[model samples]
Target: MIRRMIRLYGTWSAEYGLIRTHVLIFCSILEKSHKSLIGLTHRVSMDPSARIYSRFNLHLYDIVVLVVSNAWAWRCSTTSTLLPFFHKNLGESAHLDVGVGTGYYPAKSVHPFSKTGNVTLVDLNEATLSTATSRLRHAGYKGTIDEVQHNVFQPLPESLRGRFDSVSLFYLLHCLPGRMEDKGPKVLANLADALRPDGVLYGATILGRGPGVSHNWFGRRLMGLYNKKGIFGNADDTLDELKRALEGCFEEVEVKLVGVVALFEARRPKMK
Candidate 1:
């Protein structure tokens, strides 16, 4: 355990160093480019690479800032939606959220049991971290919750292993395109790898007809034609895929569709 701790610490330090170096480079480019643009500021100037970089940075940064500044809102919804499950199972302990967007599930909200609850919010945005840190300190919650900005595409950090009593996955998954039947089973398998044996998972999504199906079946030929444009994942894909994902991971899973929205609940299988 001691060796693992040391290794993890070293890895974190190295990651931080890399992040700092990248930030410095980005800033240097922005500063030099902005200065050079002073003369052309009046023109509708654009750089495709710069625009893409700026947008990517902005998206990550917004998540960091928003998470910290918006803890309270998260608290309310979490308390109502997820707390009861935690209370019934682990009885008021810390929890972790994967792909926790802007600390919305754990911080600054009216958790009546707030004093005993600790939340760790994880994301992959530095701008998000900076903003969240400032917001947390300003709210006088300087160290109550833990924050991590890393990709969850691989195994979760060891520091978080077996630490959460309940885990929540909000409106995640289904961002990438896939046909309905194939998509759900694959993503659920991924989520299962990260889950605690006794933990509960909850989430929601929007649903509709499969992309492969004709849009004109309901007397809407124009709408069917438009579906081929392929912007968002079709509802059929999301619905069936989510169901399949839960089945392999959770011993028991339930789903409901309310109008256009679908809700899901799953639990990691308990040891026999």
Candidate 2:
């Protein structure tokens, strides 16, 4: 898979002028052998004190991990395609993006809301927040942007509660500290509190239980190793548990499993 990814990026480098350098750098890094990459990932994942995102510098994260592995190679189908489709519903609605890493989704998704509405980006990492804010501005987003260097594991400020028309938690929950059974419900409830009446909650997450790894031997092995190392907190975060968590907070909920990722569109009911 690593060889294939290297070859794939090499092909992309030859074709695209803009990202050619970044792609070549990605290929060079991967050439160091897949095992080394996995070992590095394992070390990062296992460190409870050092979150993976906070541990890596901006260049390694933005250029290599975010650009090459996530955007170019496409790890999560929900983030790559489905989430963007749902995000189009944000037409002129105030949106809050929790864990807005590198502003990938906001940059890729058309933000009709930016002209009339505002955007609040929240993340634990200051560098990530700055990078995302800068990336969005560079991508031509002319909206009132607010950056909050706050951890999602804690409650949001009272001023932000029940303020947004939409709240996005793209690829956030699994990366958080603690068990998903306890953390997942709490996170959803906190985000739900930030939504205005009839507001929409939409995003994607990596699921530990899914068809992608079940059928592939190598994929299953990799996931097992990741889960054991605390890289993924979703080992027990099954489809049923996720549905129940959403249903507990929102009046309406829809969830679909795309490969090893879960795509969801949930809504808070309007108050009487």
Candidate 3:
């Protein structure tokens, strides 16, 4: 349906990216509404965060999220801060990326993915899976790309155990359900199971507030709305708890705050 719409209207529109973004966002809302009518409870439908990316177009994400939100709202410079952080830690061997957003890192990274390695993308949202896969391929990632439709809350299957040399959790923690103290560690433990003992787990997450967090007016406004809409569950999240969570599962943990986002790395998953 989306492909057909893109072909029908995209071919004719000068603002093709804008049109696709609007269409996809609207379609996702419609899809959510249709599901609610079918069987999803009212409570389930309220938090559209989980199913929100089902129709997201990568270009739209780049413009709005990477450009606008990261600058005016989050105040984190993607090119200088985020991209460098990602490049510094990205795995050259078997890699796992959880909560893969439109596959932006791979699509825009200066650090190339290993053509001889494997990249396993894990996400509950199929739209993200598809989009990320497309982005990786577009970026000339010659390695094997694997998509696993799975929740971060659950343990990865045995086949995935100790498989990856690196795992990324970019912008994933805050969007998860429940408070960060509970959700954060549980999710970390689940991912730890997927990594080899020497593997590194690194990624960034937007924090609600903490010692290092500073939210400007725009950031505050967006945070409030996102939390209220159930798009974010990090209203009460703190950096201390996140550090504690990472330290619990990994022998080495490092966390730095850039704007309202926390960039983190944990190595040597203490496998149980």
Candidate 4:
């Protein structure tokens, strides 16, 4: 549908162009609504055993869609694609997901690791965490999971200090800006400090490619407004930009391009 709309707009103009723009905006909203409805429907349609331990039930299809959508956005591990890095990085084989929205990554991707390990889920949204807590239990995940209402912009708690073997930034970096060029570095520096010497930080985010596809001058101005309010920044940042920023604290960095999204794995320096 999204592609169809783009194609329809390509052949039209003037009045039709104006109408198409509105249609595109409306469709974007509808797309989000549809995904949420699908997610809810999937949860309710699950078999009894599937919902046994969790409050909300999720069917296999829901996880599949979430994983694929994230992969499109350049933030996931699609089966037969990326190896299970979480299993390789953690000492206790522990994983930490920062800004974990509704536990989507863990619910959809972490199951592969759960057979032999545990994950620590952290997010600032209490409601989201509540939902995650229920879902993890429902899945009967064997790993020791921790759900915390902690803000990533601030220093993490001492109890969690130097604790994670691998941490996932997911798509959260693009969500914060205004001083992204500064704040991004500071945030990663803090994350680097929190990781054990041999630990790894895995992340994916959109990169900057000017303002193509987005509206226009007014659209750019609107984005600037969003930047001021800290709602969004560069939806995507270049690999070199992110690497140069991360190099200050991390010893080694590896990056891969997955469409418009950039995936990164940076390791903390070993102790002398």
Candidate 5:
């Protein structure tokens, strides 16, 4: 047991450096005694590449971690449930996925959308976009697939404005930089602009404050430390804040907190 723990620590340190590793360990211990202390130590800014998702590759181990691990089950559940909802409402309309990593949801739920319409996959990471495109192709997706390397923080191409009937930002907002109050609404507005009038917009985000925040001690510690390291920027993004952001951009917004995730579906009002 001690050897396994040592190996895990070594791996973490190798990836994130000794200082971060020590901080994580110290926070994990502090969480058991003074949980609030962990919250006080989070950093104000973080480099984009510091996030594990940026470094994550589509590999056998990553596949297993995404599919089989309970820690990631919330993400799978949110995508599985919401993607179908988006497809049912989309009906012969174009669809867009922002930050389509490894194309997991697209590969699994895109068949229905692809049968009658086209799909676009956008991401900042070229490698991730390439992997996602390949995965969709390998999954026998015969529909037109457009892969664009772009950052969601910036305005989308003029050609793409109001082009999609459905736009998904699943597991995306929390990974972005800056506080949710300032950044979340901006990102949502950008995505909302990409949707046609009355079009549906849906996505999920990992919340920083919620009922399930403390369910897993190790998970909480990891999240806290990751926030402190700037690997995640959702430390202040709660369920209420997410709802407010969505409501500000769309005519109707519905948000639900399932575990540590905030799942939402909204729609732009039809042009008068």
Candidate 6:
């Protein structure tokens, strides 16, 4: 028993890394969260990547991912690129958002008129789904706010078919498992089931490779860390493959790479 205990601690200390080892130990001992640590170990073995977005992690998302990671690590500026694209495609009527994270884009969007509208938030993570739903409601969106805890890899609910004026899939594709060729088309086609005939689908994803994709030292470090942690599965993702995936799902596909990120808009779902 003593030897087994030593082995476990050795692995845990190494796997948790320096900073997280300290923080998690403090959290665990202070709260007596031995069960939580065990559960966390189980979660990692299960590769439930979405579980990484705990309530605590959600609190740090905007500042850590949006502001700091976007500018310094990814070389993409939230102000000049991502924010403008999000606002340009702001859905005022019957919107659907998949893989929502802290409801950043919707919370930051500006509506030309009216303070309320319908929005369906879909995510595999309960914390993210609840956080996004609450954020939209708090942002004065008094209309229908529905939450669907569903995976994009699976088929969308039949009732949700062709029900939205616009669907946004921002920062979602890269985090999904499988190659871009395999996952991208399937997910896009499934979401196409949610969009009206003329409705547009727009969002951005961090591309892993291609001619123009730039990964500086900081970006590389972040990419390595995220991929290693299973928080990202986009190491083999490329912009050209994404374009083809979009084309297969939509009639009009527009894609551009900005500092290793591909901002895309697809209109008129081909399968719709």
The number of the candidate with the highest lDDT is: 6
Task: Give the TM-score of each candidate.
Answer: 0.52, 0.72, 0.81, 0.64, 0.73, 0.82
Query: For candidate 2, lDDT tens digit of each residue in 147-218?
Result: 987766678899788888888887787566565667877788878878888678877776666344232333
The predicted structure with the larger lDDT, 2 or 5, is 5
Candidate 1 residue-wise lDDT, 1-272, digit = tens: 99999999999999988966864564455445435544443353322211221323444434422332112211213344343433433314655555444443334533433553566666554444454455545555433567776554445667776665556554444333456466555555544554466666666544554432222222132123223323234434445556766776678998765433356777765332
Query: Number of backbone collisions per candidate, in order?
Result: 15, 0, 0, 8, 0, 0
- When sorted by lDDT, best at the front, the candidate numbers are 6, 3, 5, 2, 4, 1
Instruction: Report the alpha-carbon TM-score of model 2 versus the true structure.
Output: 0.72
Global lDDT of each model? 0.48, 0.65, 0.79, 0.58, 0.67, 0.80
lDDT of 1: 0.48
Structure candidate 5, residue pairs in collision: none
lDDT of 6: 0.80
Candidate 4 on 1-272: residue-level lDDT in tens?
A: 99998877776666677865864564354345445645564645422112121323233324433453334333444543333443344345767777665565566554565553757776655555677766766766777778877656677777776877778876667665534466677778766656777788887665554322223443343334434434346644556667777776677988766545566788864332
Best by TM-score: 6
Model 3 has an lDDT value of: 0.79
Candidate 5 at residue 3, lDDT? 100
RMSD of each: 19.8, 8.2, 10.5, 9.6, 9.6, 9.7
The runs of at least 3 residues in candidate 6 whose Cα sits more than 4 Å from the true structure, single-residue gaps closed, are: 1-47, 110-116
CA lDDT of 259 in candidate 3?
84
Name the runs in model 3 displaced over 4 angstroms: 1-47, 56-59
Misplaced by over 4 Å in model 2 are 1-50, 55-80, 210-218, 269-272
* Candidate 1 vs candidate 4, lDDT winner: 4
Off by over 4 Å in 5: 1-56, 60-65, 68-91, 210-215, 269-272
Which residue pairs come into collision in candidate 3?
none
Give the TM-score (vs. native) of candidate 6: 0.82
Candidate 6 per-residue lDDT over residues 186-252, each given as its tens digit: 9999999998888889999998887788797667867776776567899999999999999999999
Better of 3 and 6 by lDDT: 6
